[model samples]
Target: MVMQERAVRTRAALIRAAAEEMDRWGYEGATLTRICATASVSMGALTFHFSTKDELAQAVQESGGAYMTDLVDGVAARGRPALRSVVDLTVGLARLLQDEVVVRSAARLTRERPDGHSWTLFWLPAVRDLLQKAADQGQLRRPGEPRAVAALAVYLMAGAEARCRAMIGAGGGGDRDVAEEMDLIWELTLEGVAAGSG
Candidate 1:
């Protein structure tokens, strides 16, 4: 058990260090040597844990996806009210871009194409199901294509995060601004894209 615990600690330390370094220097600049040094682990240990830098990159991507999934699951269980939970889950990520860890990691992933969400097709259906249920329950308006709507929601969520990060260190965007953009999108969605609601 002690050995297992130590191994787990070492892996986590490596991920944490890699996340920090990736944020600081970006993917092209992120070096395995720096990660090993930051984690206080040897190259042999890193190699033992991960066969290659590619493997480490995959681990980080999976770790990030798992983190997002777990967060959605956790908030759903808390009974925080459904709509609030949706907003929080969607836009709350925008709020996370301010964090050194999340923002930098995202920057790194974008810099490295393999580390990005190029395979989100697997998760899109599940998201479609949830939104379809929401529309059925009257919490949201649904068009004939729930999958398209789900895709739009997901795109907007990620876009909001990127836009937020782009605006960071500028101190210009507030939650109110985000809320306003969301409100406009929702209005357009719920009321139809017809100009002036004509």
Candidate 2:
């Protein structure tokens, strides 16, 4: 039992370390030696837990997907208006992007490694469903355009992720600023796209 527990801890630590390296330098730039050093584990230990860099990156993405699942579940639990839920989910994702290194790394990896599981798959379907609900509820200006609105939400998320990455790179702004900016953008989006905006 103890051995299994230790093995689990080692794997978790390695995932976090690899995520940090992957988040900062990207997959190609992140070295196994550096990941081993960051995790404080030997190369043998790392290899035992993760046979290759791709496996480690996939693990990081899975971890990040778990986080996204939790966030989506939490937002769904609130039972808010569908449009409101979409806004909340996107904003929540933005906050996660700013705060979680694992999530940041997963986002980067989803783009860099197209063959890997995408973290977006966890939450984007929920966003699309919410947009469809909004259309059903007469909350959208062009009721037939739920997919288009979902695409816009995708763009918003991509922009938010980019902004968070920039902030991390330049040591710019606080968490509150990212959330606030997203909130303002959502407000404008709602005004323009919601049912009756003359």
Candidate 3:
């Protein structure tokens, strides 16, 4: 029993270390040796858990996807207004990007490895559904254009990811809060940015 538990812990540690390494470096740049060293486990242990780097990357992506699925499920359980839920969902995603290395690595991997399992797949459909609900309920400026709104939400998420990466690269000393910023951005988006004709 103890041996099985230890093995499980080792595998978890390996996934975390791999996430950190991949988050810092792209998949092609990350090395199994560095991942094993970071996990404080032998190469044999790593290989026993995962035979190749590709397998480890897939595991990391799956972990991230699970986290996103949980967040989406939690938001849906609350049953908030569709537009409000979209806002909260984006904020939740941004917070995850800021705080979760596994998510950051998985997002990077989705971009770096087009063929890999996409972590975004977990939440994007939820976003689209929420946006469609909002449109049906007359919450959108153009009720017929949920797709455009969904694209906008995606852009916001991408910007949040970039901002978080910048903050992390700068040693995390920045004062700006991503969630607050996203809320304000969403408000401005709904209100429109162009100056009104007098």
Candidate 4:
């Protein structure tokens, strides 16, 4: 039992180290040696857990996806208006990307991977579905254009993600800055989608 616990701890440490390294250097520049050094583990230990850097990257991506899924699920359960939920989810995700190195690195790795799927693939459908729901509930100003609104929401969230990633890479900014940006985004989005905003 002790051995298994230690192995799990060591693996988690390595994943975090790899994420930090990847966040700093991206996929091509992150090295196993640096990851091991950062994790304070030996190469043997790292190899035991992850046979290749690609595998490590995959792990990071999965971890990030899990985090995002949890956030999305939580928002979905809130029973809020679908438009509000979409805004909240996007801002929540941006905050996650801003604060979590693992998530940020996973996003970067996904971008760098040749076979990696787009992050939008994971979130866009949810956004579109929620937009459709909003329209069904008579929540949207343009009830006939849920697709257009979904596209706009996706573009805004994608932009926020990119901006947050860049800010994080450049050593981060105040949480207030992130909040303000999200507030502005929500304001604009609500103006476009609110029931009486026509």
Error of 4 at 47 (Å): 0.3
Worst 10 residues of 1 by lDDT: 118-127
Off by over 4 Å in 3: none
What lDDT score goes with residue 100 in model 3?
89
C-alpha TM-score for every candidate: 0.67, 0.92, 0.95, 0.91
Q: Write the per-residue lDDT of candidate 4 for residues 1-198, one digit (tens) a residue.
A: 999999999999998999899988999999999999999999999999999999999998888888888888999899788989888888887778778888878778888988988877667788889999999999887799999987877777677777886676577774546646876878876776567656
**Pairs that collide, model 1:** none
lDDT of candidate 2 at residue 172, scale 0 to 100:
62
lDDT tens string, model 3, 1-198? 999999999999999999999999899999999998999999999999999899999999999888888999999999999999999999999889888899888899988875975556878899999999999999887899999988998889989999998988999858898878998999888788889922
Q: Considering every candidate listed, which one attains the maximal lDDT?
A: 3
- What are the per-residue Cα lDDT tens digits for candidate 1 across 57-160? 66666666565566567656765644445555555444444443643375457547553654333234445656666666666644456567666777876666
**Better-scoring candidate (lDDT), 2 or 4:** 2
Flag clash pairs in model 3.
none
Model 2: ten consecutive residues of lowest lDDT: 171-180
Worst 10 residues of 3 by lDDT: 113-122
Q: Model 4: C-alpha RMSD to truth? A: 2.5
Question: In terms of TM-score, how similar is model 4 to the real structure?
Answer: 0.91
Query: What order do you get sorting by TM-score, best first?
Result: 3, 2, 4, 1
